[model samples]
Target: MTIDTALPVAAVMAAVPVRDAAVAKRFYERLLGATPDDSPMPGLRQWNLGDGVLQVMVDPERAGGGLATLMLDDLAAAAEGVRVRGVSLDIAQGEVVTAVARVVDPDGNAITLVQA
Candidate 1:
């Protein structure tokens, strides 16, 4: 089938599956430094990160099997923030030109924070 050229498409939220919604909510709140902006429905929590939305949803089947990457202004500062929250970041590799850090959530979901 031919695609429509007049249609408009835009990127939306990224869903990260978690075992428990409540627990994940608290973890994300601490990481983002703010409470969830909205919870559209049960088992789903969302945070507005300026350009896009990050959704933490309860999904036992796929929990701990998700991955998300966040591009930040300062990787060091962000890593420090995570450490302050009692969360350790796994520094898989660091490039002098572009700093990057990896962290796993309570449910084992991988999150890569990169300095841009």
Candidate 2:
């Protein structure tokens, strides 16, 4: 039961449940402006999100059951990009002066973009 904080940890993958993997894949590609890194399994798509991996998979029972918050270098630019792709965002209040914009995927999974 001892932990080693000094050891390097492996990358983390955030999973987002979707009703239709194909639809989610297209939405995410437009939203992130990149194709999936790989599809290790059927009905599963993975994207490299800098610090971590974003996995979108089909799971009828758990569709729309996850939330991810991404920190961006420029909030305005990111918002505009998504907007151009026909994605609407809700600019909400943040804890500090940071700007936060939120959007939901086809399956209703929430993705929040933040700029500090």
Candidate 3:
């Protein structure tokens, strides 16, 4: 079969709702190695993590239990940066680009940062 299509999307945004905006902001800042650009919304923040944006919004009734795995070029560096920021590193699994490390945000959201 043959089909015609345009190129894929240029960017993506991962929106995550947190119970506390302040805590969420701090957690993401540490994970991304930088602060997120504050959104005009009263309780929303965003961080540009290269290929995609990490969005955090405040909602007292929010719940956490989602995972966002990032494909990083420099897994060691990224993991080190997170550690330097006081984030605990999990046990490493797999090998090469398949290695994975699961870390939790201040709000208790689980995120897997991998090299692939």
* Cα RMSD (angstroms) for every candidate in the order listed: 3.2, 2.5, 2.8
Model 2 residue 62 distance off true place after TM-score fit, in angstroms = 0.6
TM-score winner: 2
Let me know the TM-score candidate 1 reaches against the reference structure: 0.83
Q: Per-residue lDDT of 28-55 in model 2, one digit per residue for the tens? A: 9999988999999999999988789889
Give all candidates' CA lDDT scores: 0.83, 0.86, 0.77
TM-score of model 2 vs. true structure: 0.86
- Against the true structure, whose lDDT is highest? 2
Q: Which residue pairs show backbone clashes in model 2?
A: none
Q: If both were scored by lDDT, which would come out higher, candidate 2 or candidate 3? A: 2
Cα lDDT tens digits, model 1, 14-97, are 889999888898888877778999999999998988688899999999999988888788777777887887777655446553
Ranking by TM-score: 2, 1, 3
Model 3 regions lying over 4 Å from their true place = 1-8
- Candidate 3's error at 64, in angstroms? 1.0
lDDT of 3 by residue, 1-107 (tens): 87769877899888777888888877888877787766868888887777887778886566485567777877787788889998877647676656788887766
